[model samples]
Target: MTLEELFYLHNQTIFKYLYYLLNDEKLAEDFTQETFTRFLHYEKSIKAGAELAWLRRTARNLAYDHYRRKRLIQFVPFLQGHEEQEPISPHQWLLQQEEAKALYLAIRQLKLSYRDVIILRKIEGLSIQETCDVLGWNEGKVKNTLKRALAVLQKQLGGDWDD
Candidate 1:
């Protein structure tokens, strides 16, 4: 495939990673663009199958960049207007309002380890191995941690998290 087509194929995954990390479409879009811009240098050398891994790595870097930017931006002395809305399908329409509220509360209610597992596994769609890579834990630790995370979610959803 051509270089542009290679980019188009993996772009959605990159944006998905960014969206899960930032939980904001605009920022995800920005990071997706930045990912490709940086990727241009190495695009010629990478094979098609390897592109997904490359994009994931780029997305990870962009996520960290975003975190650093947010820390800097938070100290700003001014405010900007809120973002406008986009139309949504019925399923998405529901999550647009209520899911954010419920998810915010649920994550806050979870223990830190449980919350991290849920975010990495469910939100970012990371595999068990990727979770281990990101969190620097062993496979057994990942499995046990994931078990506890799900149990915590079950308890939280059974009460405060029902939506």
Candidate 2:
């Protein structure tokens, strides 16, 4: 497929995946564009029917690399820039149940691996095989990590967990 067609088909998916992980719009857009740029560079090596997987893998790696760099400098106070969103109005904030909001916060607190699996598999509705492709993990690792992630989430949620 041509570059235009590839971008048209996968840009949203790629961007959403990055946004969900990073929660930073500018970074997501930057990485999404970079993924396509890298795709163009290595397009010849990608096999047929594997374009989406290849793009996703590239996006995931880019995000992880960015996260790694961010983590390294996170301790440098002056180097950090806060990018808070506009405050949620009381009405809008009240519209969401407290439990749901807490759950989301807890998810964000989980380790990167667990958070990635939960977001991709549970939130994004990707199948096991698809999650594996995006994460470059085997099915067993995915399943095991997901199980542990859920357990950690439950612990994080305290008695808020119904089951």
Candidate 3:
């Protein structure tokens, strides 16, 4: 597919994935753009049908690099009384809902592995196998990590989470 077509198809997905990982809309947007820019550099090497997975992996790596550089003590800025930015879209509006905010907070408290599995498997609705592809993990690792992540999330959410 052409670059424009690929961007149109996967942009929101990548952006949301990054948003969940970063918990900062502006940073997520920047990483999303960087992910695509890296794709431009490596497009010739990426296999067909693997573009989305590649983008996700790239986004995850970028987030990791950012965290390493910043050495942040806190991941969720909103909880720290960071000034709220006006919602720019329906998705942003949804993210501001009480439940979504609580969930994001809970997810932010998790270790990166748990956060990644939860985001990829549940929030993003990626299948087990697809999550494995994006995370470069085996099936067993993905399933086990997801199970543990869900349990932790449930406990963190006050054991009220249905799933």
Candidate 4:
């Protein structure tokens, strides 16, 4: 497919995935753009019919890199002030619904593996095989991780959590 077609088909999904992973809308937008930019550089190397998976993996890596940089910045007093916090947007306010906010916060508190599995399987509605492809995990690992992630989420959310 052409670049425009590919973007049209997968951009929102990629953006939302990044947003969920990063919990920063502006950063998510930046990473989503970077993900597509990298795709442009490596498009010829990517296999056909696997574009979504490739995009997801790329986005995931970018989020992880961002987390690493942020963690490192925390230790360097000089670099800390260089990062500016953006004002929260109206969309962010809309996310303040009690249950939704609680769930989002709970997910953010999870370890990376658990958070990723929950986002891909439950939030993004990716199938087990698709999630495995994006995460580079075997089927068994994906299933086990997803089960554990759900259990943690349920516990974190308490009585409000429904199966």
Candidate 5:
């Protein structure tokens, strides 16, 4: 497929995935565009039938790399941006709900592995196979990680596993 077609089909999915992972719409948008940019850089090398996986893996890496760099530079004081803000998108609305807000905070507190599995499986609704592909894990590892991640989320949310 052409880049335009691929972007049309998968841009929203990639953006939502990054938003859930980062919890920042602006950063998600930035990384979403970066992900597509990186895709174009490596498009010729990517194998057939793996475009979505390629985008997701690239996006995930970019997000994690940004987090790593942010941590390293976080101690340095910086001025806030002076630009005007854009209107909130629908994904931002979900975080405004009481339960969702609480859950989001709790998930953010979890370890990266747990948070990633939870977001991939529960929030983004990726299938086991898809999640495994995005995370570069086997199915068994994905299932086990997801189970443990859910348990941690349940405890963090102050609810029982049955809830």
Candidate 6:
């Protein structure tokens, strides 16, 4: 397919794909724009049938660049003013939230290779080959990292994992 046709057809799907990776709607939109812009040049580099893979790789690199820029800028996510207020009895309402936060913390503490596998497999619901493609990991490495990540999470959370 021509690059224009690909962009026209796959833009939203691509945006959603990047959205999950970036976890920021606006940032994902920007990366989608960046991806398409880069696609114009990178399209010729692809060997016809490989355009989709090229787009994914280019978008992944762009997402990393966006995150690197965010890190350098010390960016904090913006929030609505009213949502910033603390609850009078946060313990009562925030039990689930606390658990989720704990889970996120545990995930964050993992090494990046392990973390990527877990996010792709568990959170993003990608299959083994998809996760392998997204992270450019071989099958064995992806399986090993996923195993290690789950073990880490299990050990860290202890019995809470069952809940």
Of the candidates shown, which would achieve the greatest TM-score relative to the real structure?
2
TM-score of each: 0.57, 0.80, 0.80, 0.79, 0.79, 0.68
The TM-score of candidate 5 is 0.79
**Tens-digit lDDT track for model 2 on 66-150?**
8688773111001111346578788875665465567777887787788888877777778899888888899999999998998
In order of lDDT, best first, we have: 3, 4, 2, 5, 6, 1
- For candidate 4, write residues 27-84 as lDDT tens digits: 8899999999999999999999989999999999998888797783111001122246
Give the Å shift of residue 147 in candidate 2: 1.1
Which RMSD values do the candidates have, in order?
7.5, 6.4, 6.1, 8.3, 7.6, 6.2
- TM-score preference between candidates 2 and 4, better one: 2
CA lDDT of 106 in candidate 5? 76
* lDDT comparing candidate 1 with the true structure: 0.67
Which candidate achieves the best lDDT against the true structure?
3
Model 5: which ten-residue window has the lowest total lDDT?
72-81
Q: Is candidate 1 or candidate 3 better by TM-score?
A: 3
RMSD (CA, Å), candidate 6 to true, equals 6.2
- In candidate 4, position 117 carries an lDDT of 84
**Which 10 consecutive residues of model 3 have the lowest summed lDDT?**
73-82
Error of 6 at 45 (Å): 2.6
lDDT tens digits, residue span 1-163, model 6: 7767998877876676676466678978888888888888766666765555566667767876777777732112112223555655757557756666677777766765666676667765677887777677798998888888888898887743431
Q: Name the runs in model 4 displaced over 4 angstroms.
A: 72-96, 160-163
Candidate 1 lDDT, tens digit per residue, 105-163? Answer: 65666665665567667756778887776666788997898887777766766754331
Q: In every candidate, how many clashes are there?
A: 0, 0, 0, 0, 0, 0
Scanning candidate 2 in windows of ten residues, the lowest lDDT window is 72-81
